[model samples]
Target: MKIAVAGKGGTGKTLVAGGLAYLLARAGYTTLAIDADSAPNLGFLLGLSSRDEGAIVPVSKNEALIAAKTGTAYPGVYSLNFTVDDVVLKYAVPTPAGVHLLVMGTVASMGAGCTCPANSVIRALLRHLIVDRDEAVVLDMEAGVEHLGRGTAEGVDMMLVISDANRQSLAIAGRIARLAQDAGIPHIALIGNRIVDAGQEQVLRGFAKDRELVVTGMIPFDPAVVRAGIDGNSIATLEGSAALCAIGGILSRIDQEIKERLNGRVDTEKHS
Candidate 1:
């Protein structure tokens, strides 16, 4: 399963992405967690040490590697097709919990102007990871789906738009869902995070119901999560924490959905 997690700043989307990846890895799935955010903090949440995090040079910033894959000469002229199969093996840092992390910093040329070599390399690598890789890939994306082109978005199985109880966060989530839909992403769901009480849950449910959005899961506000973040510790390590338990529930739901889809496909084939 290829999943993309997105949310406005301070929404704890990174935590969710890291937790999901950890869960998949712990379940014996080869998981690749890609940090596609501009200010990538998934590394920290995934329990990478400061030195290890600093050692990771994002694909977008690796000028030499980008040039080698894309082109050397002109700015606009570059190869759009490049092999990125070795990227995971070569660059991905293995965590103690068995998840491989690939930090994809923001695609610089994606802002304005023609696509540059960096953009080509980043896009190609992302496409390869999402479309070709068999492992469970989790992308911790930027606030928006700006990095997701039509082709990349189509390859993703699900897009989880996380939101707090705040109006601005929900608005961003709605915008992200629309963008994902426009880009041909098949499944889009909202994850309510930091939901403190019944009132917050009701607000999220009401928002989803009114907007016709799918609420995949809700995570209760846990002080343990906050402490973990403050202490620069991995929440996944706190196995019995309320937030971790909630994330496990979400992962189970996702796994069940995947199983159902696979079973449906097998049944259809048998009938045919």
Candidate 2:
């Protein structure tokens, strides 16, 4: 399953990615969670500390390829010899619940000329690193579909657009859905993060319907989550945390949707 979680800033996209990755791993599936967001909070959420640059791998093509593509003068003798996997790092963090994790480095925002490299880096490797894998991969993408780059939107299986109660966040999520649609991405759903109670749900559901997105689930603004983060604990490892409970519900729905989609595809293949 290739699940990509994207949303406007501060919508808790990274948390959704990390939660699902942790959930699937605990469910006995080997999972790879890629933190493709420019801010890259998954490392912090997962409690991974690394001074080594290896922890944050770069997405540069082979030095030769980069030079060739950019028409840059070669610095010196070089051999083009690294495959995509060579650039990814495995962060093996132990969880009491037996969920395995592997984290990728961050990307800069899709901002200006200075961000061109990060954007290109994300665009280039985004495809091969995602849909071409056997193990389930979850991508935590930046707000909007900027990470989809150009002409490769078909690789994403499903995108969960995160949003808070704020209108700005909701507005951006609608834009994200449109971008995903433009990228030829097939499925999109919405997750409203930081909902205080069910009373706020009326507002959330109305916004979701107005935007033509599904209000899949809601995560409460739990202080336990904050405390867990403060102590450098994995949200996945948060015991008796309300945030985790809500996230688990979200994961269950996602799993069901994946299974139903896969089953439907199998039926289509058989009838054809």
Q: Tens-digit lDDT track for model 1 on 65-151?
A: 887788846766777777878878888998765799999897763435448777777777888999988999999998777777778
Local distance difference test scores for all models: 0.86, 0.67
Find the candidate with the highest TM-score and give its number: 1
What is the per-residue lDDT of model 2 for residues 1-272, given as tens digits with 9 covering 90 to 100? 77889987766787788887777777788777776665566765655654422355434423443444333345543323323443334333433334434443444543333334334544555665675657777787777665664445677667888888888887888888888877788878888888987767777788879877777788889888777767777655675677777888987887788799889999999999
Clashes of each: 0, 1
Give candidate 1 misplaced runs (Cα > 4 Å): 72-76, 108-114
- Say which candidate scores most in lDDT: 1
| Residue pairs in clash, model 1 | none
TM-score of each: 0.94, 0.79
